[model samples]
Target: MGLLDNMKARIGPAKEKVSHLAQRHGGTIGHGLERAAKLVDEKTKGKYSDKIQAGTGKAKEAMDRLAHRSGRSPEKGEAPQAGETPRSASPPSSPEGPPPVS
Candidate 1:
């Protein structure tokens, strides 16, 4: 096998295991990320507040994607209430008018 293939084979199982664990504890992981970000922002005396917020948001988004890949995503607005069929993950259709003129 090629070098890249060999490396992927070795890493694939570990990645799958990590993904499984992430799916199971995604909420906790997300909370931990938020907590850390808050602590860092406080330590910096609010100097990097905006950057920290953006970083935290990106981290949460990545976690959600990982959880979703393992079929454990619990995203709000993506869940169906009792007696309702689960909706696809597709974005809702936009109500904005047609594309603007060139």
Candidate 2:
């Protein structure tokens, strides 16, 4: 087998173990991430608030995907949660189409 395939085979069990752990303790892990982000934001006096929030959100999303909770996955077709914009959503298009040439 190829090197990458061999590596994946070896890593498969570890990935499963991590997924189980994430599924079991996802809530606690997410809470910890939020707490740490809040602390860091306070320390920085909100200078990096936006970036910190974005990082925390992405981390939580990753954890959720790892846990595979609620059948949410790219392969399964994810539905956005309330108040969330879907990641693949495009910006609204102009009804008028392209701007008129000068």
Candidate 3:
């Protein structure tokens, strides 16, 4: 087998273990994330409130994905809630390509 395949095989069990743990403690993990974010926001006096909030949201979504939570993800053939966008959706691509960097 190729080196990458061998590595994947070795990591498979660990990934499964982590997934199981995340599923079991997902709620606690989410609470901890919220608490940490709140403390950081307080410490920063809300200077970076928007960035912090965005990061926290992304992190929580990632955790939900790892735990295989159904509520956070739209199942096949299911429609997302009003005002909610699925993670799989991306912004419209610009035919002009990326904007120039300053």
* Candidate maximizing lDDT: 2
Ranking by lDDT: 2, 3, 1
TM-score of predicted structure 3: 0.67
In terms of lDDT, which candidate is stronger, 1 or 2?
Answer: 2
- Please give the lDDT score at residue 73 for candidate 1: 32
After TM-score superposition, what is the CA distance of residue 51 in candidate 1 from its true location, in Å? 0.5
How far off is residue 66 in model 2, in Å?
0.5
The candidate 1 region of ten consecutive residues with least summed lDDT is 80-89
lDDT per residue as tens, model 1, 36-100: 99999999999999999998988887766665566333456676533335546577888799987
Tens digit per residue, CA lDDT, model 2, 57-92? 988987877787433324335775543567777899
**lDDT (10s digit) by residue, model 3, range 24-50:** 998999999999999999999999999
TM-score of each: 0.65, 0.68, 0.67
lDDT: the better of candidates 1 and 3? 3
User: How high is the lDDT of residue 22 in model 2?
Assistant: 94
Error of 3 at 56 (Å): 0.7
Q: 17, model 3: CA deviation in Å?
A: 0.8
- On TM-score, the candidate that comes out on top is 2
Computed on alpha carbons, the lDDT of every model, listed in order, comes to: 0.77, 0.81, 0.79
